[model samples]
Target: MTSARRTAVAAGVLFLITEVSAIAGLALYQPALTDAGYLGGAGADGRVLLGGLCELVLVAAVIGTAVTLYPVIRRRHESLALAHVAGRILEAALIAVGIVSVLSLVTLRQDGAAAGADEGALVAVGQVLVAVHDWTFLLGPSVVLGVNSLVLAYLVYRSELAPRPIAVLGLVGGPLVTASAVAVLFGLYGPAAHAISALPVFAWEVSFAVYLIAKGFKVFPVADRTVTAGGMRPELSVA
Candidate 1:
């Protein structure tokens, strides 16, 4: 109904899109990411390209969520809202880099196979591209998302933009995931532990998206002004 309500729903949809695209991209990338000889064969080039496409969609959606929420959050705190947008932009940029790396790897595979290029060299190059993608995933989604979630959660919590439980999830999840990512950077957490740590943040985002979609936003009440003999104008009240 209201513009603010529409914005919340749109942001939710974008968040959902990000999740879907990220999952689809990763699933489609498995052949090149896991198999050492994937680049040698011509079977899965299309699959990897499709994966790259999904990631491009993900990049768009990632930025969309930030942009959609920017106006609402900026009203509460302009600087932090800017930080949220900046963090999401960085994440999207990193995701774009990863997409490019994968696409280049696909090109390498296709051309190398056709030209009778050295299989060893092609595979090595492919692995390097995959490594680039992995780094981007780590830095972009894991690290940057944590900070973005914190900023968003703080704004929502203070402003009552969403339910308190959802905001609390972000508050707790943000620090946990960020710390987990840092530990992963330092080789302190293995794959399983890292995944476990990321669950909280994932839960936060999922719940946030669902709530925004289902309920839009919790409307805060503003003060009603009245005119009298001695007019005393009051500032708008926030809930």
Candidate 2:
């Protein structure tokens, strides 16, 4: 297989890994929220720590995947270098957000209630940390993933090389991702208050993975160069 195809395959695998790990970790951690109004008693704190650690792994998986495909994306879509760079910045920001989230979880875990401490005060602190977790987690990844998705979709639409569905997924999934992230960040809907901010993102990642694995990096061949009247040759292709 060509390098581009190989890169696409690798990108797909990374996406798959990220989603799986995220879901698995979340599953392990969600039960910790069993107590509705408040957070962090002894049992809950331990679960939160495990969950946070899982989240860290998930973030690392995503970053690793992006880094692997960065060169491929640059080569394939030179026109989108700026977008790709923006995506990278967003990715870094998202990773930082994940780190903060994990730290917050750790903090809540460490600060287990003191004897006779006001339960209300503890709940308030939990609420605050959860709020921080919600905003950063959504905002960072949404912008980055959304832009990257648009770029990928455009590239797919323009190039005949990749399976049309992969491009189509990029086009459709990108905006949904951005909107969902924004909704979560802004807490637009009551449901948005939930900690599953990354669920839509997980969907997009999974779609990308499927497309890459199934289609590889199949782009339309660039048209041949031709000489103009002035005898100067320029690269041009018929749309």
- The prediction achieving the highest lDDT against the true structure is 1
TM-score of each: 0.91, 0.72
Model 2 global lDDT (CA atoms, 0 to 1): 0.62
lDDT of each: 0.85, 0.62
* Model 2 alpha-carbon drift over 4 Å, by segment: 31-40, 114-118, 183-188, 192-204, 220-239
- How well is each residue in 1-239 modelled by candidate 1, as lDDT tens digits? 87767887898999889988999998998888888877887558778889988998999999999999887777677799899999999999988988898888878888888899988888788889999988888888888888888889998898787899999999999888888888999998675787788888888888889999899878543444667678965444564
Where's the lowest-lDDT run of ten residues in candidate 1? 219-228
- What lDDT tens digits, residue by residue, belong to model 2 across residues 56-137? 7777766766576665544446658456655755765665665565456445545655444576776776667666654665
RMSD of each: 3.5, 4.4
